[model samples]
Target chain A: MNNKVALVAWREYVVRVRRRTFIVATLLTPIGIGLLALMAGYFSTKGAVSSKDILFVDESTIFRSADPTSETHVFRFSDKNISEERDNYLENHDVLVHIPPFENLGDKKHQVQYFSEEKLSVMTINKLERAIAKAFKNHKIKSSDIDMEMYNSFDTKVVFEDGEVLEKIAAGEEDASKSGKLNLIIGTILGATMGFLMYMVIFIYGGMVMRSVMEEKINRIVEVMISSVKPFQLMLGKILGVGAVGITQLAIWLILIPVILWIVQSTVGLNDASQAEQMAEIAQNMNGQTSLEGFDIGQIISEFQSLNWGLIIPLFVLFFFGGYFIYSSMFAAIGSAIGDDMGEGQQLMIPIVIPVVIAFVMLQGVLSNPNGSMAIFGSLFPLFSPIIMPARLAFDPPMWQIALSVVILILSCIFFVWFSGKIYRVGILLYGKKVSFKELGKWLFYKA
Target chain B: MSVLQISDVVKQYGDHRAVDGMSFNVPKGSIFGLLGPNGAGKTSLIRIITRITGADSGDILLDGTPIQKTRVRDIGYMPEERGLYKKMKVGEQLMYLAQLKELSASEAKKVINHWMDKFDISDWWNKKIEELSKGMQQKIQFIATVMHEPSLIILDEPFTGLDPINTNLIKEEIFRMNDEGTSIIFSTHRMEQVEEICKDIVLINQGKKMLEGKVSEVKQKFKENIYELIYLEGELKNDSTYTIVQNDGQKASLKIKDGLRANTVLQSLIQQGIQIRKFEEQLPSLNDIFISLIENKTV
Candidate 1:
């Protein structure tokens, strides 16, 4: 059985690697991911595409700032009837931002209205909202002889007091870096989870293996297979063989990524490892910002480093393999049950995948607080742990938590294997019958 | 030594009895035919023996120890339905099947190449199963099955979709395997093929065994009490002693009563002025036997 399993795994690995589909997917991944990132980064970096005009109507001169630019235009009215000004602006500008006369008699509120041919971007509306608040601040500062410039910049701070100043202490660094980190984390999570996603890939692809098996069983090829190898050995070999194929393709990508990275760094000259390493080391050695002009290698390394990867890599690998085997076994079982074709197996498969699907949606929340109740509870549950634990590890989950999740995932794999095997034994040979969930459940629990 | 023994096997699908107390033995070194009509429990018995599904209440013995999940490798099964990975290449597909059956990569390649060569399809090594014609796919599938060298082989309608040349190709291989000491159980609706190749057979209909024995024994046993006589001029009549079941101009078939014989039928026909050109007992073919069995059950 061991030898057969080893053989099966090896064959699965080899043939899958050689498969044109596997080759295509693996090759397309990095390029596809890179292009997607570039497209998204370019669009957001260009500020979400807004060139529309924002007309500002002011009753008081203080409300009108010094000659608002083309993007932002301000109109002043001597008379309370601003209809004439509105008509003039409407004949030319893109949108109307009406500012009603301020009544400071008792209330600080102004009855403002905004009208446009089309709805404005959320960012523009948000900017208008802030501008209104700042206008109110200007009215409050009216006769105090206060420093408006100092106050305009008061929304920021730079404190340097005692301890080794963290780079985040640079004040606006946190928010500015926050968005970048969020997007980066999202991208990394996607890339890192590719291996984990392979669990899904294996089940999908491995289900294909099982479907193929059942087809033969339906047709009687499995009868031929059983003649030489034990059913257990055959099942294991198939799983391992296909699993190997998935791993090999990934392994090739693993080897290829570094090589590709090296080649890019060499070609571009910006990613020179030695230079990167030196800059990284120099940034690490720097105390505070002496000039604050050079790279905050900490930020670069923070993305690549500053990580609790001690927990990250191991859990990722564990969740990936464990999740893969668990799902693939079901797929195998389902494949055999379907015994007909890919379209049929998809029936049982979708229901089985509900737990994983729910976990993925909760991942955003899970990443926010690894040790939180949701993450911990979700992690303890076998299905979600495969997706949740690795994501949570980016924030450094406790050792016991990580260990527990791993243990659960491992045990779940074992249980699922035995369960799926029972189904597989019955399913592969069943032909001419469309299997149902109820029938499958019965097979899962039936005594040998 | 019997490679497979199915004792008092009973199988059901819902309320339908697919195999009702079917009992048969596939002795070592023989090609045993499991002959039956379309829904005649042949597949049910095969599935039971393969342990694909268990018999509702019965025992299937492989080499005298009850067949279990671990005993699957001892039996090779070629189902009537052809199941191959449509998108997979011939060699890779075979290699995948081989690996699953516990052959090393090198061994898988050797066996696959040998079979591919033997089937004269070595040039199709890189072709996908879908790319091949159904017959060619059959060859590939056949290789995938027998490559593992199982002791007892069960083939349900192995000749399906094969042209005469390919059919001969498969037939020759089945005989060669039998000669080399491989016990085989084959099920098909084609009666002539059974007569041509099978040494012993179990005939089933409506999930029950109608007749089981050597091909010659079944023919000889049912041959009695019926005579086919061709006469130039005669009145073939239905009498109390003999019933004329079929008559067409110059030829007639008579079903003789218990006390009567073929000679008696001939004498009665002669006395009735029937000049017989030929007089012989009609031997029932497997096809006639199968249809009669089904008709009897319906009655």
Candidate 2:
């Protein structure tokens, strides 16, 4: 039996892997995911490029007294009419830029008229506005006795451990990029993405398994197949075949997404700085206020560092396979009986598919109320729990609740397998006959 | 030793009796045709013997022991409705079926390849079954059935969809398998094929055996001492003493009534200045007897 079952499994895997559909799915997944990653990199993320630059043209009656660079500039002219200098400046610069003349003193709504050969970044926009505002301020400051650079106010970030202030890093120095919040956001996103992947694979790919079984059974090919293997063995072989195909697709996606995303990021970074500057300039341009006073790094670290991965991954994998098999096996059996052809197979599919669809529907609710009665009770149902329970558990769910759900899911899967096997054995052989629930019941209970 | 012994088996589908106490024995090394029409309990009997479906009563013996579910592995059954997984390759499907019948991998491949060559379908090995023509599909289905070399082979209308050329190809293989000591029970509505190949035969109509015996003996049991005669203008020189059955001058056929010896009639014609261009005995064909028996039962 062991050898035979292995042969059946090996045969199923090899044949399906050689199929055109499987080959297309395997190759297309990586390319699709890579494209998705590239697209995502283009929008808003850490490594994406910015596209705009603005040239400061602060011509005001107010006297200017400040330093300048490409990032921060003040329009300083030797003559009162420096319009000739602007022509020379425009001729020398190669960058596509926005040129806003700072003239209107106290406009309430639209302050300054700006012109751009292209779009501008928030950082450059803010710097240009500050330079012009400073020219107006300089005349007032010159009238008084204050020096401008002496009044440069710099903002400071505060750190706290639990409730007390931390004067220095553990390494006895502070790092330039304070990335604790960024790390927290990325980590949370990764955890949620992983959980969603499992839920999606089970709910979607399990349907694919059912459709494949329906294809074979509708054509009456499963009759020849069942004669050789026990109905249980055939069901196992099919589920495993789908698993192998799915993992192959996932493997391709895993390899290509990072590689394509890297390329897209590098490509976009080469030419555009406006978009990239906008993201970083959010710290000051919008609100000009960011305070991390008395912020505890310990809690952020503890939220992630103290996470128990020993509990989640193994349980998730177990429930995923168990749930996938149970749903797909039921589909195989029901698909076989609906009709002796593909058209009729779909009629039966709509009803059988309701469970997986309902499971997906409850996923949002699971996320919203991980411990709500609907979420908790739904996590105990075999079909829905595979998707919902693992997800709720991703965010530090109670160990006992997860354990109980897994136990219930595992037990129900065993019963479903037995029930489906009986249906598959009898259903695969019946041909040219209309099948009903009543008729299927007869086949299931009728003793031979 | 007999390869299969089906004794007093009964199968019912609801109130309808599919096999009414049918019993038979298949001696080893013979092509036994279980003859019947579309719904005449032939499939029901085949299912019981193959252990695909069980009998409501009575028992089946395999080599003198009562057959069990596990014993089904020893019986190779090719059903009337042929099936092959369309997206699956011919070689792969056959190999899987071979393993299902308990053949070791190497043995299964060797046998599958051998049969593939024998059927002239080695080129079809890697091709998907759906790509093959119906005749080619039937050949692949046949290979799947017989690849394991089970001792008992049961085929139900195995030649249903094949063209004449492919039909003859499978026909010879069936004979070859039987000659090599495989006990085969061939079921078909094509009585000509059954008549040409089967030695011992069983005829069932309306869920009951109408007749069962060696082909010659069963033909004799349905004898009417009748002969259909065909004669040209130069041949029919006879007349007044013999009653003319149905005679048109260009074409004539007659059934020899009882007490009429064929040779005596021929001599009488020879003496009567008549010519006997064609002389033949009208033996009952399996088709003739099948139609007559079925027609009788319904009436």
Candidate 3:
């Protein structure tokens, strides 16, 4: 490094690192977020599935008695007088279901009622509904006097073009939808966290660079600084210095997140052991009950693990820095041109801030359909691509799109750096008057 | 020997010409004054000398070599728009600037300590610039500018914001530095200070050199052959030989025409029976010369 640039960079890095606000914000915020993630993970995995007891009373003499028990519920049948049934019957059972007798075998009128001490879970209610539907179908068959064997032959399964392909695709879509819910929620959280950080890091540090330039310009230290070092070096040094601070903060958070998560996971793991015992007892008592078909929590977890992190992570770092460099250079130029007036600096920031703001807004649209036109445009647009592209990585977009977005982003970054450098050289010395955009346009044509 | 030279430097900003074919030289070990009114391109010329901004069409020679980017390290430039980072501590800010001038860390620290003690601001080393008064910050800036001990030092209105005591202190230091063989370029509109310190001066107006010579010679060139006389008895009469510019009962000033001697006027005044208490030839002050030159440009 040139000694002058190193010196300027070092000063910027040290001064910001020493600030209490930087230290507190960098360290405490991640720990807080980690704790929140910990709580969410713990609750989701700890005893969320439910089991219940159901009592069945059959008063009808026209039909044979049937037994229906599921893994998530136990059914106990009884023949009791209707007058003996009390309102407080739930003290012993979770649910009491009654089927009233019909006056004639051919009568279609029948009444049923269910009483539960607590509101039944959706899964438990769905299981009961399916069991009732099968019983009714059996009763209807008996009344029709159909031959059981002949009727059984008519219960044929219609096969599609290929069962394997249908099953595989259905399973794939199912896993996708399941894991999609899993990954997207997790992805959105992670993406939003990282995106918010990227937004703040770029905006805050870019503002810092701007303010630093303005400070030097206002104080007229820039003139003395320029005499010893080129304006480009000064701007680069500040960008690098402030950038290093941001990277340092991010690195600390990166390390803290996993460490805190591990602690939380271990704590939750201990609770899962006791929960397993209770679940096993419920499974034993409710024998023959169907388990939730196809939507295995384990499979969803493995899908989360299978994400292409190798590609996503490296790309994230690249875009984070590339985006930061692009915005901060323009901010530095604006700072230089603003001279001593702070109000004009803010007014000028609109141009610099608009692209990033639009990127974040487009991020919302991308979340709904990662393959949508808006998503593709946001991912490809150099200004929005840094934030949008990384978010789309969870959706596994085509490799060519990622590569193209990256190429455009890198090229745009280089162009902006050179462009801002031109303005920075002349703007630092300007004073008294606010610089308009027209003047900056003229500066672009000046000879190096 | 000239330590620095500028030949035909021109800088144009849009349709306006900021520096138009200006030229000057700074003799080695002399205190040179760069004088101009506001908006007369004094800053543009200084910026070019410091290499802060490049000249549109010209060359500047420093120590007989053409000025390059690296040559700025040997020249200390303190501009009129002086400032320091208000949040930075005095010691650290100075260290950063001194190191930018290519001084080693230990050497910079040693020199910084020496200057802080010299300026009596050693106690402010750890204090943020905002904690110090404005004059104190100026002192720190001055220290930072000179800490590397450059061969050529340029100060633009260095004493503007300072109180009288601090101003005198800086003036003494400027003189002391010049005496030790460092060429100094002092730019200011305050001609009195320029008269006291600078030996050679270049007065610029509207981006062009209006006057360039030694202070003594420039004043001599502008002399109008005016003389002031004070007597206790009578007033000298105005005539073709000498015109009484101003007169009172006992005091008068007269202008001699056609290369007439002051002795002739004195002898004539005595013949008029005026008891001569004080009789001396008067020279125009730098203030008068600067005003006349710039006003001449406007006219």
* Interface DockQ of each model: 0.28, 0.41, 0.54
Taking the tens digit of each residue's C-alpha lDDT, what string does model 1 give over A260-282? 65554455444233343333334
Model 3: DockQ vs. true structure: 0.54
**Arrange candidates by TM-score, highest first: which order?**
3, 2, 1
- DockQ for the candidate 2 complex? 0.41
Model 3 C-alpha lDDT per residue in residues B18-74, reported as the tens digit of each score: 999999988999999999999999998888888787889988998888887445568
Best-fitting candidate, scored by TM-score: 3
Docking quality of model 3: it rates as medium
Query: What TM-score does candidate 3 reach?
Result: 0.79
Q: Which candidate leads the pack in lDDT? A: 3
Candidate 3 on A142-207: residue-level lDDT in tens? 768987677789967552243443576586744333333445545655566666667777888888
lDDT tens string, model 2, A1-448? 5565676667667776787877887777766765775565455433332433333343443433354444223233334233554455445332322233344444322255454444555545666667656655655555566666664443356543421112333444433232344333433443446557866786567766677666766666665665556567777777777777677667777786777666766865623453335434553445522222223456545545544558766877787787777777787778667654667666666755687678777776666556788878878888778777776765555678887888898888888878887887677667788776777777776445
Each model's TM-score for chain A is 0.63, 0.68, 0.63
TM-score list, all predictions: 0.71, 0.78, 0.79
For candidate 2, the TM-score is 0.78
